[model samples]
Target: MSNGRKNSMQRVSDSPRLLRLGAGASPARDKQWFCNPGSGAWPPPTIPGRIMMMNPDQNSDPLFDFADADDYQRLRDLLAAAGFLDESVLEAIGINDLPDLASDHPLLLDRTAGGSALHTLIRLFLMEMPVEADTFAQAIRPMAADSWLQAGLVRRHGSQVTAALKLLPFRNLILAFDLPALLQTPQRSRYVMGIGGSTITLSQLTIRRHCRQTLDLGCGCGVHAFLAAPHSSRVAAVDLNPRAVRLAAFNARLNNISNVDCLEGDFFGPVAERQFDLIISNPPFVISPESRFIYRDAGLEADSVCRRIARQAPAFLTEGGFCQILCNWAEKDGGDWGQQLAQWFGGSNCDVWVMRSESLSPAAYGSKWIRHTEFSDGETGFSQRFHQWLDYYERLGIASFGAGLITMRRRSNGTNWFCADESPERMIGPCGEDVARGFALRDFLETVQEDAALLACRLRFSPDLRLEQQFTPSAQGWQVSGSTIQLARGLAFQGNSDTFMANLMIHCDGKRTLQELLPDMAAALKADPARLAPLVCQLIRKLVEQGFLLPAGQENES
Candidate 1:
C-alpha cells in the first residue's frame, strides 16, 4: 500500500492537471483547456484520441423478416407491377384458399412464419408459370406454350414469365429472368453457402490491385460486385435477370456501398464498352439438359459458356486489363481443353492462363446437377432427366468435363500459356491468384500436361531449428521427422522451391537448441535472432499447429 501510494504520488507529480470545459461544452471548443492550472505544464501524450474507435458496426438489432398486412399489401402492389403476380390468376388459383394450395406445393404455400422470393405463394405461383394447372404437371410449367395446356384448372399465375422463371426449378423451364432486389445478398444461404468451384475460382484468380473500372458479368446476387467495389474505383455488375439486378442493387445498399451500379441485360449485348481495367465472370456454364435456369444452365450449344465469355470479355477490357473467368468446357474431337481455350483467343496477342483446377467424370457431374434440381430423388421425371444427361454425354464422347481458372490479358507482346490442370494431392484454400502472376501462370500452364502441379510443394525443416530425427524416403509418403523443441515448437518447414527446401534441410543440425544455433543461423541466413524472431515465431506457431513441434513449458521461456 505504501509503495502504491508512492507510485501514485510520483504519477501525479509527473502528470499535468489540465483545464476543464464547462458543462455541455466540448473540450475541443477551448484550445487552452489542456494547460495544467497548478503546474502550467503540457500533457504527456501529443496524439489524443489515437486509441479511439474508428469503424462502428451499423446494425445492433435483428432485422424484421416477416411482412405485416400493410407491408404485405405494399409489397404485393410492387410485385404485381414488377410482373410477379396477376390479380385475375390469383383469383382463379384461389390465393385465399391457402390450405388447398399447400397440398400441391407441399414444400411451399404454407404462409408460415416467413415470406421471401422462395416462399409458399411465390414458389407455387412461379412453378405454375403462364397458367398453373392442377391437373397436368406438364401444363403447370410457366414456360409451356398455351397449346400444350389444353386441360382443366389451367389458371394463369404471373403476368410476366420472369418472376416465375426466378423461382422455377423444373428441367424444362427457361432462365430468362433476374432476382428481385430484396433477395440478392449473402444474408441468404442461396448466395453465400451456395458458392462452389465457380465462385471460389473467380474470387481468388481475378487481379484487383491495379483495377480502376471493373465489370462483373452475370453478377448473381452481386457476389463479385461486393468484392470488386472495395478494390476498384468503379464497378458495374450486370445480370440478365431483372430480379437478380435488383437483388444486386439491394446488396449494394445493404452494405452502404455506392460505387457499384447493377444493370439488367442479356450477355454483353447490354454491357457498355471501351473501358475496364478488368472483367470477371462465372457465367451459366452448365451445359443444360434443358433450358430451365438460364443463369446456370447455358442453352447455347457446344462450349457456349466458354465461347460467350471469350467472345464478350475482350470488348470491355482496357488496353492492358484482363478478363478472368471460371468456365466448364469440353475436350472435343481429341482437342485439348487448353488448345480449345487458346483457339478462342483467335490469334490475338492476349496471354491466356488456363489451369484445369478440377475434373469430374460425366456421371459425377451429371448426378450433381440432377440432385440440385431435386430430379435425382424425385418421382418419375428425374430418372428420365438423369438418363438424358447420360445420353448427352455419350453422344458427345465426353471422357470428362474440366473446370479451372482462366485469365486473359490484352497485351501485344509475346504470348505465353500456362496449364496447371491436375487436381492437387492436397490443396487447402486456393492457388488461383498465385497462378495468375504472369510468370507463374505461364509456367504452370505450360507444364500442366504432365500432372505434376498436383504435388508441387517441397517439404523441409526450419533453418533456425535443429532436426531431431531425420527419415529418408520410404514406400509410404514422406517419412521424415525432426525435433525443434526450443527455437520452434515443431520440426516442419515450407519450401516453395526445391533449392530452398534442400538448403533448409541441410541447416537443420541435431546439435544445437534454437538459442544456441541463433548466432550461426544469423551468420548463415544473414539475419540476427532479434531480426528473425517474428518470422521464426510465425513458422514455429504453424509447425506447432501441424503437430511437428510442441509447445514449451512456462518455466522454459522465463
Candidate 2:
C-alpha cells in the first residue's frame, strides 16, 4: 500500500464527502443505506439468523417481511409459467436494464398484456411498471397484495400497485435486487445490485465441484452464494451493507436456497475464524479516491482490497482449496504489474494465477464508472468528483489499472508459483473446468522438470483444440501468413504454430508417449533425435498449459 492510500484510509474515518453508513441512521435518511422493508424506527429488530443492532422499541416493525418457502414455490411456478424465468425470454423482451441503454425499448411496449398471472407479474416486477390492484392481487394468488405491501416489495397509489425491488431472472434463478435507478436518487449509495456482466463472469469462473463449505465475501445480492448452495454443503455469505444482507437473505429464500447463511459486517468481520473449501468474491474493488457505494468502492485506497483479500485468504482456505476473486490493481510508478501482484501472494502458501482481461487508462476508467453511477457531466460536484478520481490516480503515479480475475489454490507443501498472463477477451462456455485443468497441468510441469520425464508422459490433443492455416494472395501468389493453433472452447487460447508442430500435435493421440514418437519425428524433420527431443518436450508443456493438449488420463476428465 502507498502513503497516499494510508492517508486516504485515515481521511475516510470522517470523510465529509461520504454519508453515515448504517451507523444508527434511518434507512430513509441515510444515503449509504437502502430502506430495509423489515426494520422499524431507531435500532432495528433482531431477526433470527441475523446480527442486528438492538434497541427495544415500543412500535412494531411496519415494513418488509421475508418470504416463506411456500410463497417462493408459488412465485417460481408463476414466473416459469409466464416464461419470465428464462434468460432468453428476458433478453428477447430487452428487460436487462444495463447502464446507458434506452430503458423504453420497443420490445417492452406490449409487455403488460395482462393475459395471465405470469404476464402481470412480469409487467409488475420485471418491467418496473405498476399493475392494476385487482390484477396484481389475482396474479399473486396465495400471497396477497397486502402481504407484498407489508413486505415493502410494493406500494399502493390509487388503484395501482408498484414494486420497490426489481425481480430479475438470473441463470435458472430469480433474484430480487434493489432497483437499478435507485442509485440515481438522493439516497444513492448502497442499493443491492442485480445481475450484471461482472456478477455473471464471477459465477461462470467459479469452480463448481461439491465442497464442504463456501464463503461469498461481499456477497451483495448473494448470487454467488445462491449458485454455490446446491454444490456445497453450506455457504456463509457476508456483506458490509445491512440492507444488502437483508435483500440477499430475501433472494436466498425467494429461490428456496436453504444452505446459505447471510451475515452483515465488513470484509472478514462477520465470518471470523472460519475455513472454506471455496472462497469467492466480486468485492468493491473500484480504484477510486472516495467510497460512494459499498458495492463498488472499497475505500481502502487504490487496490488495497485486492492485496488484503489475497493475503488473508490463505489462512481461511483448506488444503487444496480454491479462493477466486475478481479485482482491479493500480499499476505502480516504478514497479512491474506482474511483480507487484506477485508480492500480494508473497507470504501465502498458495499458487496464484492472475488472468488479466483488460487494462484501462485513467480517463477511460473514470468516465466508465461515473456513467455507471449515473452521475452526469451536468450534475453538481460532478467535475470535482471526476477530477478527484483522476488526481488520486495521478498522485499515486498510476499509469493504468489492470482489471482481472485472481484464482489462488492453497498448496500445503512444495514450491508455490505466481503466474500472470493475458486471457482471451471472451471466454466461451463454463471455464471452471478449464481453470482446474490448467492448475493440474502447472503442477505436472513442476514435477516433470527434466526432458526425459516429460517425454515419458503420453499426451493427447484436447477435443476442442483446433489448428487453422491462413493465406493471402500476394505478388508471390498465396503466401502463408502463419499457422494458428488454439483451444476452441473454454478460455479460447489462440497462438502461432508451424507445420512440424501441427504434425506433432496430430501424432499426440494418447496411444504413443512423446519418447516413442521422437525417433519418427526426427526422421520427418531430417534432424537429430537429441535436437527434436527438447523442442517436442517444450511444445508439449506449452500445449498442455494452454489446454490445447492434455496428458492421457486428464483427457477423459473434462
Candidate 3:
C-alpha cells in the first residue's frame, strides 16, 4: 500500500467518535429479528440513533423455502395467477414504495373483492400489513398459509397474522429479502438489500459469456450469482453476512435456480484456492467514513475493499477469465486519479477498463449516502450524520469520489493494457456483448501492432453508427459548423469529427481494405493520398477502439 492509502485507512480507523462500539452492548438486546453477527461482524460505534442490533433467534428466518423446486414453482404459479408478480401491477396501484401507497388505495379499501388472492397476498407480504388469519389462509389457499406461520414468515397476534418478510416481485422472479423500518417495525440494522437500480445496472453490464465456474463476491441476496448460474456450470455466491447467505439461498430457491452455492465468508476467503472463469460483485462499495449498514459499507477507510478486490481478483481468475465490479474510489488530494487506480492493477497481468458514470465531491457524496441511510430517521438525525460524514472525508483528504464499473481480464501473455474512460451518458440495452467485443478488440490490437498490418485488414463502420451535422443558422447558408458521429446500440459513444473523417468512416463498407480505400478517399477529398494515409489510419484506430467502426469479420461476433 502507498502512503496515501495508508493515511486514508489510518484516518478511518482513528475516528474517535465511531471507531468502537459500547463495551456492554449485546446481540441478545435486540429481538429475534436482528441479524446474527457470528464471527466476522464488526458492530458500528454507538451513535445515539445508530447503534447496531442483531438477533440470533432461528424463528425470525422467513418461512418460504423458495429453494424447493415444487414449492417454488407452485408459489410462482400462484403469484402469476394472482397478478401480483407483474411490475406494472405495482405501478398501476401507485405503490412505488411502502410509504407512497395510500391507506385508501383500492387494494386496502376492499381487501376481498371476489376474495382476490393477489390483493390479500400483496397487502400481507409486499405491503407488510396485518390480515385476519382466516382471510390470509383463504387468500393463499391450496398453498396453505399455516405453512407460512411454521416457516416464521408470519406471526399470529390474536386473530390477525402479520408478515415477517417481504417477497418482492422482480423480472419473472420473486426475491425474498429484508425490508427497512415501517410504521410498526423499529429502524432495522439487518436490512438485506433487494433488486434496485444499482443491482439492475450491474446485471445489465455483466458479460454473458459461457464459463465453467463463476463467483459472485460479496453476493447480497445473490442477484448477480443468480444471473450467472444459467450460463455457468457452477457459481459460488460468497458473503460475510450469514443472513445474506441464507436470504440469497432462499431467493435461489424462490426462483428454482439450482446451480448457485451460497457460502458465508468475506471477499475471496471462502474460495481461497479456487479459480473461476467469471466473477461479479456488487459489493459494499460505498466509501463510508463510518459503518452503518453491512450491505452497503465495508467499514474500511476509503474504498479499500474495492481496491483489494480489484488488485487480488486476478489470482482467482482462470486465463482469459474476466472479473467485473461496480465500485467507488477516492480521488486523493495530491495524487493523479487515473494513476491511483492504475496502480491497483500493477503487476497483475490483467487488462483493465473502467467506465466512470459519475463523480461527487466530498460534501455532495457524504450528503447523498447520509440521506439514503438516515432518511427514515427524520431530518435532525440526518443532519448530524451528514456533517460527520463530511468531516471524515476532509480528514481522509478525499477531494472527490468517482463511481464506475471495472472489468478486468487475466491474460496469460505478459503484455497487458489498461483503459480508463467515461461510459455513455445513458446505457441503452444489454451491452455485455459490446464489452466482450471491446476486450476482444483490445486483444486483436495487441496482435496487430504495426500500422501496415492494421491497414491491410478490411474494416467497416458499425450498423448502429450514425452521422450528425451541426450548423449555426446565420445570414450565410447552413455553413458546416461542426459534425459528430454516434453509436445507436451498445455502449453509446458520440464524438465530433470533420466532414472528411465522417465521410471517410461512412464510405468504408467492408468491400476494401484500408490500404485500398485511402487512395479513393484522398482523390475524392482532393488531398494527397500519401499525406492522408497516415491520418486516416490513425483516425481508424481511434474509431475502432471506441466502437464506431468494426473490422469486417468482427461485426457478427458482436
Give Cα-based local distance difference scores for all models.
0.45, 0.71, 0.70
Candidate 1 has its poorest 10 consecutive residues by lDDT at: 1-10
Off by over 4 Å in 2: 1-63, 66-70, 91-104, 111-114, 377-382, 471-481
- Could you tell me the lDDT of residue 483 within candidate 1? 27
**RMSD per model, one decimal:** 22.7, 7.7, 9.2
Pick the lDDT winner: 2
Colliding residue pairs in candidate 3: 34-55, 63-151, 66-253, 66-254, 67-253
TM-score, model 1 to reference? 0.49
Steric overlap count per candidate: 24, 3, 5
- In candidate 2 the C-alpha lDDT for residue 43 amounts to 20
User: How well is each residue in 1-558 modelled by candidate 2, as lDDT tens digits?
Assistant: 000111111111111111112222132321211223455432223234322222212233322343443555666676676676666455545555433224764556565463577677666776678888998888777666766776668879999998888877777788877776777765467567777677767777888999898998877778888999889987887776656666777777667666677766655655565788999988777778876675667767788877888888899899999999888888876777889889888869999887877777899888777666745557656667778889988998889888778999999797898888776545777888878878888888888889989999888888897888889899989977678886777777777787788889999999998999999899998999997788788778777777788888888584
The deviation in Å at residue 547 for candidate 2 is 0.9
Residue-by-residue lDDT tens digits, candidate 1, 288-363: 5665545446566646656767766766677777887766777655766666667777755566656554566778
Quote each prediction's TM-score.
0.49, 0.84, 0.82
How large an RMSD does model 1 have?
Answer: 22.7
